[model samples]
Target chain A: MTSTTCREAMREAIREAMLADDRVFLMGEDVGAYGGCFAVSKGLLDEFGPDRIRDTPLSESAFVGAGIGAAIAGLRPIVEIMTVNFSLLALDQILNNAATLRHMSGGQVGVPLVIRMTTGGGRQLAAQHSHSLEGWYGHIPGITVLVPATVDDFRGMLAPALADPDPVLIFEHALLYNAEGELSAGSIPPIDRAVVRRSGRDVTIVTYGGSLAKCLVAADQLAGRGIDAEVIDLRSLRPLDDATLLDSVARTHRAVVVDEGWRSGSISAEVSARITEHAFFDLDAPVLRVCCAEVPLPYAKHLEDAALPSVERVVAAVDEVVNVRA
Target chain B: MTTVASPVPATLAPSDVELLRRMLLVRRFEERCAELYSASRIRGFLHLYIGEEAVAVGVGAALEDGDNVVATYREHGHALVRGVPAGAVMAEMFGKVEGCSRGRGGSMHLFSVDHRFYGGHGIVAGGLPVALGLALADRMRGVPRVTACFFGEGAVAEGEFHETMNLAALWTVPMLFCCENNLYAMGTALARSESDTDLTVKAASYGMPAWSVDGMDVIAVREATRRAALQARAGGGPVFLELRTYRFRAHSMYDPELYRSKDEVAVWRERDPIDAIARRLTGAALLDADALEALDAAAMEEVDAAVAFADAGTDEPLSDLTRHVYADRRGERGPEEERT
Candidate 1:
């Protein structure tokens, strides 16, 4: 078993995939020489050579489209958008081409492309640089969206994404890069399902991406107050692990969803919708959400903290869902 | 007959006369298709390829057999030149069971895997990325094939256009981006839309070689496409060629010619590809009036047979409407192990 940070685990997983298959290559701006803004692609240019470790021009659509093209051509291309905010430039390629090609072509062509983008805001990088749109992307059909929370999840999610016969978008949280965990050698964690980070019974805490850690901390806070919380990390965002969410909410009869995306039409909203629809009879309290404030993320640390979901906010949300007074 | 015959192009050599015949076959075929649309024999948005024959004629001839081709909705010319039989293309247009896309794509959408013509993509610039993808495959295989993508000038404004150009240029993949600059994109002309009128400059700005040629001239288009195709297949990387062409008719069957004046349309009609080629042939004494008449007669006969073939084709069964939505796995040996 190797003790690895989320960033190292991710780097090794992609490196392993590239080394294992000639068809697998990484393309992005600053991915080659700069070794990625988060250094997840560090040492890849040296190992894979510049051709495979492609440094794209400041054109996200073209490279993403090219990656889609390569994916359809039989190469398992992994496109790294510097951040989820930058992915809007390539939305046409992702939505119109990559997502629809398989069905449009009558299943003749499968887009086996992996698009990995860093998501969530904590670094005070300002409005344009900081965003979490993975929830919005998850709304689209025909592609899988993975939001890996732990180091193990980071190491385990890449292979299935590369192996899937459809397009997959992995939203790696910027704040989780340094988070470390133990992993058994050759551990291939499943991404198509949710995982329990902590177990509880009084209330269920559901979250993913950068908010999963905050959820776990919130769960610990709930435990001291004699409220048992079940934390479910939604690893895959698109084909959301509905079974896990429904089962947890059904048992606890209470739920709280935390996400860094804006509250309106966020994944939290979708999860809450699903819980209300699926686990309505079992729930004693209304499904609640602790989402990012509806504003472009602020640059200053205090303002930035106010914008995103914090551990205190998660705790407050859980308390609201659990401690109802007459 | 409700169907009209497309004129036979004259610049064609005996070998190219056959090519011109085939191109006219596409023009006439699509014209009949438009008639079918009126008759309710075919449905969906119908985009006819009335003019702009030479661009497809020339570029389609430049590529080797089985080379991947991605085209737009106005793609009858591309399908015809890419070696999809007139019967199949006509059948597809008629929404017959034997159509290239199994009747799933009526008029606007057409796909022929055997011809390697990916399909007639309806979205303006949607085919660009898919075409570049086919090139990616060829490059990876080290095969002597180039993915030739056909698109309109309207697609130039799409963000995907810039994105795909940068990717293809940065990666240096073997792709020939053939821009069919037909002046108008659904009533919006290049003059009214583009900040940069010269589209080749945009391609050149991507750090790749580009060429601009008269698409109405089949010979010139063929020569330029051949040269560009050679550069791409030889691993010289992608080339963007903006073919200055026009549509003799309105954008689609539904359109009214309110944007351009009738005089403007008639003026461009004089420089028609088929007529221009014939004039060039007569000057060289390579083709006479009788030779031109004989070619036109032959084209009419072929087109008649194509219409009959399309008429005879059957429609797809209602049960099969849901058949091709997704691929079914046969459970291949190996790769059963969890990848991650």
Candidate 2:
């Protein structure tokens, strides 16, 4: 095992994919000489040359659509939209073309394209850049949504995403880029399944992406208070891995969904609804949720922290669910 | 309407005769479609390419077999010329399993990978970027191929059009941007919409060769497309062709067409592309009245066959509704499996 940051792991994964396939090329704003806006693709320009590591104009719809087109025409294009905020500019292309092409064309064509974008908050980048809108993409059908929170996932998800016959969107949490973890030489986990990060029996804490760390920290805090919390990192958002979620909920008999997006009509809402619908009889109490405050993310550090789902908030949510019948 | 004298060649080649035949086929087919729509057979946004048949046929003539085509909703003529069978196109409008897109996409989204016809994109200016990508792929692979993108003048108002134009020129991808400027964008006239009605100027600002052609003149469009396609194939760069044309019918089946006058339509109709070509052919002693009648009869017969095919086509089963949302990856193991 080797210790590395999520950025490094992702950069390595991209390098490995490019090296393995001549068809795979990375294109986005500032991906080449500028290295990447987040510097995840720093040394790639020199290693792969400009053709493979292309820096595109700030035309998200055009480049994203082009990526879809190239993928249709037999090239595996990895399009990077700098952030989830910037990705809105290309939303039409992503929703209309990439997501709808295969079904729209009656299985004649499939967009085997991979789109990578930075998501989530905590950097004080303000409302435009800091909002975690990956949930919005998760609502879309036809595309797979993956959130790689751990270093292993950061290093692993790209290969499977690139290999999929349909379009796959990978949301790299902004906060986790600098966070370091051990990269094991073991087999990479499947991209579609959710993994249990910290197994416990008292309460189930469901979260993904940046919130996974907070949920884990909250789980540790709950352990000190004699409350065992099973932390589930929902790796894939769209597919939801209901079996894992339902199984954990059945075992624990309680649940708390932690999400960085707002509570209303969010992934947290979906998870809570699923647990209630499927595992209603298994519950000791009502399924609770810890989500971002329904407001634009503030630029101030304290305000941003208050707005987002924190370790304290997660712990409180778990405490509420665990102590419901007590 | 400003009438440009017919530039028909004195001695017509067999290929030239074939061009007239193709245009007649599109004309007759769409005429049948109008009848069918009136009778309530084909449904949902039937954007007829009645007056703009020459542009699709002309540009189609320049494209090689390996070339890719991305067209807008008013693309029956484009699809028919691109070699998507008349039956398939008709069945697509009929929402049949035998349709190009297997009844999933109705009139506005006909697609056939075999003919390299990308789509019948409903969104204005949506296909431009896709065309750029197709060409970009070919360029990266060092393949000599062109992607012909067709959109109406309305697409020029969209940001995607500008973005695509700049990228196509900047990347030097082999793309032919065929803008069918049919005077009005649905109801809004070109002058009312764009500050500058000159579209070629907008295209030229991107540092690419852009020009206007009499869209009613099929030969002019064909020659321009050939020249542009050659330049693109030779790695010169993208080229934009503003085919000055008009749609005789309403934008779609639902359009009342209250924007223009009957006189305006009549004036443009006097310079009808099909009639102009046929007249030129006759004047050159290439096609007599009897041969013209035969061509019309043949076109009508083909359209009749297409209608019969569409009428006999089957409806796709509801159980298979969820298929193709994500490609079925049950049998094949991707590269990741091998690596693991």
Candidate 3:
């Protein structure tokens, strides 16, 4: 096993994809000499040269649309949007072109483009930069949405996304960039399944992206209080692994969905509805949810911490589902 | 507006009658489409490319094999000139399985990767960046391919148009930005929308060479586009051409013609591209009245056959509604293979 941070894993994935395919190139706001806005592409320009590691103008729509066009032509372009909030500038290209080109063209065109962006609230970046809108992207049809919370996923998800025939949007949680973890040798996880991080039988703590780490902490706290929580890290967000989620919920008979996005119309809401739809009879208690408050993520550290899904919030939700009287 | 008067060389020029026949085909095909829309045989939006036929045919004649074309929703003419079979394009409008985009694109989104026709993009200025990218890919591979993007002057108001121009100019990508300045954008006129009425001026502000041509004149469009394309292929970077023309029909099937004066339409119709070419051909004694009638008859016959083909075409299966959403990754025939 090799230890690495999310930043290193992301950079490594780009390097590997570039080394493998001549068509694969990276383009974004400050991806070259400036070393990327988040420093994920640091040193890639020197390693891959300016052609592969391109630094584009601050025009999001043009760059993103160009990426889609390149993907349509013959190249596999990995476009970094700096952050999920800034991706709104390129939302037209992402929604109208990238997501709809293949189907709209009646299968004639396939945009094998990878759009990586930072998501979630933790740093004091405030409302503009801190919204976890990967759920918004999950609503798209032609695009594959992936949330890589682990070091392995951060390292491995990009290659498959690049290889896929359709466009893929990867939401790398802003707070998890420095989240150091060990990646197993030659053991890359698939992009379509939700894995059981901590298997148990009392409750299924379902979460993805930044909230996975918080839910794991909540699970550890629950175990101390005589409750065994099965933590399921949802790596794939778009085609949600309903079978694994339903199976875990059936075994545990309880679930508490954790999401960093706002509760209403959030991915957490979708997962909760799915469990209720499929595993309604199997549930011993009503499904609970721990999500960020409906208000826009605040700039103050205390308010931002409160507005986001925390370990304490997850623990309380888990406790509520577990200790409920039948 | 500064107009360039470069004579199109005889060797590279298409026969005068051939250009007229191409335009006649588009006119007849779209007229049939209008009739089909009225008869309920064609559903959804139908934007006719009647008056703007010369821009597509002229520009299309200048393009060499393996070149890319990115067009707007009013793309029936562009699709036909780019070599997407009339039958397949008609079938697409009919939403049949045999259509260019397998009937999924309908009227506004005709696509054929085999012909390198990217799409009939619905959004204004959306195809510009895609065209830039196609050129960028070719430029990176050292392939001397020029991507010609067709959009209305209204797209100039969009940020993507400016952004794409800057990028294509900055990167020195081989691209031909063909602006069909057809007076009105849906209902809004160019004077009502753009601060500068001159479309070529907007393109020139990006430091790219730009020109204003008489779009109603097919020879002018062909010559200008040919020169621009040759320059781009010769490492002269991207160039823009504003084809000053007018659409004979309403924006779409549902428009009530509430925008412009009928007199203005009449004035523009006096300079009809088809009539202008037919007059020139007849005046030159190269095309007789019988020959012109024969050409028109041939176009109608082609349109009739296309309609028959569309009528005979089958519908895409209901089960396959979600088929190409992610593209089939299973078989050996993948998206990569299709591009190659």
Residue A11 error, candidate 1, Å: 0.7
**lDDT for A220 (candidate 3):** 90
Q: What is candidate 3's CAPRI-style docking category based on DockQ? A: medium
- Candidate 1 regions exceeding 4 Å error are A324-326, B1-12, B85-99, B102-106, B162-170, B201-208, B276-326, B329-340
> What ordering of candidates by DockQ runs from best to worst?
2, 3, 1
Off by over 4 Å in 2: B1-11, B331-340
Summing lDDT over every window of 10 consecutive residues in candidate 2 chain A, give the lowest-scoring window: A317-326
Q: Write out fnat for all predictions, comma-separated.
A: 0.45, 0.72, 0.76
RMSD each, Å: 5.3, 3.1, 2.7
Q: What is candidate 1's lDDT per residue for B1-340, written digit by digit as tens?
A: 1111122333446566655666666677777777777888777778877779988888888889968888999887788788777777778777776677766665667777677778788888888877877787677679888899999999999876887888788767899989999899889989999998888888888888878888888888887888888889899999988888889888887899799888988888888888777777777677789888887777778768877888899976765554443344335312221111
What is the lDDT for A232 in model 1?
A: 91
Model 3 Cα lDDT, one tens digit per residue, A215-305: 8888898899899999999898887889899999889999999988888898888899999999999998998888889898889999988
Q: Mind giving the per-residue lDDT tens digits that candidate 2 earns over A68-179?
A: 9999999999999999999999998899889898888888989999999999989999999988888999998889999999999999999999998889999999889999
TM-score of chain B of 3: 0.94
Question: Which of the predicted structures, 2 or 3, would earn the higher lDDT when compared with the native?
Answer: 2
DockQ class, candidate 1: acceptable
Per-structure clash totals for the candidates: 4, 0, 0
Docking class of 2: medium
